[model samples]
Each structure stands twice: as structure tokens, then as C-alpha cells.
Target: MFEFCADPSTLETGPWFACYLTNGVHLLFYQSFLTVLLLLAITAPVALAFGFAGAAASRSHIAPLRWFGQVYTSMVRGVPDIVFFLFFVIALDQALEWINHQIRCPDWDEPIRQGANFTVCQAAKIPLSSSPQWVHEVYNFGVAVFTFAIVFGAFAANVLFGAMRAVPRAQLETAEAYGMTRRQSFWRVLVPQMWIYALPGLSNLWMILIKATPLLFLLGVEDIVYWARELGGSRTSQFAYPHPDWRLWYFLFLLVFYLAFTRVSEIVLARINTRLSRGQATMAGEAQRRAGA
Candidate 1:
């Protein structure tokens, strides 16, 4: 960013290092860390919301809704997660583009699926072909985030569903005895108490989500993994900053990043668990009560 950085190639070793770190591409590489954070921030809540809905659906009095929830939760559990991540992003993208094609190119005569190729109208292309590179990156990242949320949501649903069931039946009965309807008992009694039981599963899911952030690169997002590969490869004489192969160091950085993330998540989740157990009937709650007394 300094005026001396006007000619990066001509700069001395110290100046070269300074300019290299301050270069526009390097800034983007750094911001990719924030992108990971943003994905996690958005995905966690969306996934949890989906989980709550799925868990509720599983216990619905209506047979079809219950079946839908049960199937969703169970199906994801048996499948490899990477398979779902790959399949969902492509499937969802094609599905959206296909729908757009039908609407945008109503007069087009070509079939969408001709052998291996899946063609859509120019107007139906996501972000359109004319859009900038960053737009394409963002579109891909959005798809990746949504896919991650959906797949993880199923696992979260299973955890939440079991946790909801684990809430003591007598608590619901007591609410009913006080003239509360089933729905009221669920909302006022059961839902409030299920968190203590759910915390452990949800905590594990959070760590998994943290580790999975790197998969954003696999989905074509220009995330840290993408940048690491780009910047870490040995630069030749043609590039201003020539360096030796550093993929090992790049991946090592990634490993440390994820480990740090998981550690932070564990500390935060533990604090949340303590807060949730403040007045509950679980072992943690009982311990807290004894300590307070």
C-alpha cells in the first residue's frame, strides 16, 4: 500500500515482503477467513431452525408429516456426508436453473438433459455468464452454505428429536393436569427443558460444521482452501513473488485454523451448557443447585 510498492518486482527483499502481504489478492485471501465465519454464522442458525422444524414434524399427529421428518432424519444418517454435499449443490443448482429456463426461454426447443450435458438458457444461468468472477464465487458459496445447512440439519433434527423425547413424560402430564393443552405443554414445558439434553449433540454438530468449512473450496467457492492452493504453489520467474512449493505449509495452516476453531467452539458451547443447565433437572443442574446451596 505504500508508495514504494509502485513496482513490486523491483523492490528489495524487505519491501517485497511488505508489498506481498499488502497486495490486493492477499487481502482477499485474508477476507476468505471472514467468509468462513459468515458461512458458519448463517448456517448454524438456519440448520438449527430446520432441525427444530424437522423434530416437530417427526412428532406430528399427522402421519404424513411425521413420516417425512423421520425419513429426512434417518436417510441422511446412513449416507456419507461428502456424498450429500456434492449431490445437493449440483442437484439444487440444476433444479433452480431448469425452473428458470422453463420460464425465461419458453420458446426454446432443446431438451435440458441431452446425455451428460445439462443445458439451460443464457438468461437462466446463475449470475448470468456476463457477471463478474466474484459474483460467480458468491453464487457458488451461497449454494455450498445452503447445502451444508440442509444436510447437517437432518443430523441436528435427529439429535433434537431424541432430546425432545427425552424430556420427562411426567412434566407434560403435570402441565396437562394444570389444564394445559398438548400444544401448550409442548411449548411451555417440553421445549423449554429439552435444551439440556440437546446440548451435547448440538455441540458435536457445531464442531463438525466448523471442520466442514474447507469443503467450500470443493464447491468452487474462492475460500481459504482455494487461495491456499493458488498462493502456496511454487511461483515461477513470471510471477513477481517467486516462491517454492508450500502446499504442505498452506495445508498445515488450514489444520491449525480448524483446530483453533474447534477449541473455541468447545469453550463457547460449554459456557452455553452451563447457562442452560442453571435450573434444569439434569445432573449438571443438580450439581449447580448443590453448589448454590
Candidate 2:
């Protein structure tokens, strides 16, 4: 900002605009875009992994495992997403603090719940009461990531559960005839084949997940949405950088960001769908064969 405009007060028009846009706070605002992307990148695969485990557990011969998977997958279906977001973050925070209290302050005899306050020993507070600002930010980011995984993982499990069942029963029978144990055939055969059937539903899920990234604000993570509203709100002339209510423009930028992201994703997913279709008996495979001939 200094290189662009030595004194923002002295500058006008072009130089002033340049310096204002490149201000330190604006830079942090730009970096929040990366924060959103990183959360998506980290959360998507973890959610998928959890979903896979849930789907497999649902199919397990063990009764307790099957019940757990069913309950987990069903848990999110009837709840409003916004309500769940608010409820889970608070619930998870308290749950962690309680566990920490149990471990860190075992000798303390006071009940944690006293009237409206849920207090733990100072040592048991997440990030501790004395930890630095960055520690708090990191902890909040972690909770946001985990919250996203749990909710989306349940939806992914349902999609995968259906996809796994869609695989031809004859395929599994053929694997068993070759003396493959249920677990062996499951890993080598069913898992490989399930994706072809699952891709459509999973692709929709990926898009939904992309749209859902903005919910990080509700979880108290300083995400892109948070910064956008902060930076674009009305700024008084008393401030170094004064501006009107420019929130409309800020939101327009986010709109374009998400649009470009989804556009690229659709292209990539289409390519992957084509690749996965090879040698399968789906209509796409038939079309590919006809095209080659």
C-alpha cells in the first residue's frame, strides 16, 4: 500500500483507489477466500471417508454397527440445516470442554452446570483462556471443519448406501463363486463398481458442499462471507478508508466466485464421469463404444 500511495490522505482518484484496495485489511479479506477454499478441500475428502465408513457399517453383519450407521445417516434428514449448525457447534464445544474438565481438573468437585453458565477450570478451556489469538482461530477452524464433515458425511452415506445396493447382485455372487470372502470381494469388487452408480448423486453432493461453505460464518469461523460483510459495510469519513454501503458489490464478487467454481467443477466431474463409464454396461459406455466404431 505504501508503494502504491505514500499518503492516502494526499492522493485522489486513481492512486487513492489503488491504495484503498490494497490496504492491509483488504489483503486479509482477500486471504479469506483461500480460507473458504481450504476448508472445502480438507472437509470434502474427510466427509467422503466418513461417509464410506458409514455405508460399510450399514452393510455389516454385526447388529450394533448396522444400527449405528442407520441412526447416523438418518439424523440429518429431518433437521433444518441452520438449526443443526447452531445446535452442533454449541453442543460440540460444551462436550469437548466437559471432557477436558474431566481429564484436566479431576479433583475439582463443583458441577460444571451452574445456572446458565457452563464453567470449567481455566486449564480445561479449549485454547486455554490465555492462549494467543491465532490459537483461538485455529481451534474455531477445526471445529468448523469437523461440523461440516459430520453433517455432509451423513448425506454422503445415504447416497453411497444406495449406490452400493445398485451394483448387480450377480457381480457379488460371481466374486463369491471364485472363493473370495465377503470382505475381500467387498474391497476389491463392490467398492470399485459402486462409484459408477454413485457418481451422479455424489456429484450433486459435491455441488451442495461447495454451496454450503458459507455456513462457516455461523460456526464462528472468520470466513469469506464474514470478511465480505465486514469490509463492504458503510465506513464513515472518520475512518482512513471511507466508503458507502458497498455490500452489494462485495456480494456480487462472491457470486462470481461461486459461479466460476461450480462451472469448473462441472467440467471436471463430466470428464471423470466419462472416464469411469468405460467398460461399464451403462448407457454412457454403450455410446462411447458406438462412437469408436
Best-fitting candidate, scored by TM-score: 2
lDDT of 2: 0.91
- Candidate 1 accuracy as lDDT: 0.90
Candidate 2 worst ten-residue window by lDDT: 1-10
**Segments of candidate 1 deviating more than 4 angstroms:** none
RMSD of each: 1.5, 1.1
lDDT of 2 at 207: 97
The CA lDDT at 133 in model 2 is 90
Clashes of each: 0, 0
**Worst-scoring 10-residue span by lDDT in model 1:** 213-222
What TM-score, to 2 decimals, does candidate 1 have? 0.95
Query: Mind giving the per-residue lDDT tens digits that candidate 2 earns over 1-293?
Result: 67747667778888888888898898988888888889989999999998999999999899999999999999875677779889999999999999999999999999899999999999899878789999998999999999889888998999999999999999999999999999999999999989988999989999999998888899878888888899899999888878899999999999999999999999999999999999888999899999999
On residues 1-293, what C-alpha lDDT tens digit does candidate 1 reach at each position? Answer: 77998878798899898998888888989999999999999999999998999999999999999999999988987788788877877888899998899899999998889999999889999879999988988888788778888889999999999999999999899999999999999999999999999999999999888878878877887789989889989999888778899889888998898888888888999999999999988899999999999
lDDT for each of the candidates? 0.90, 0.91
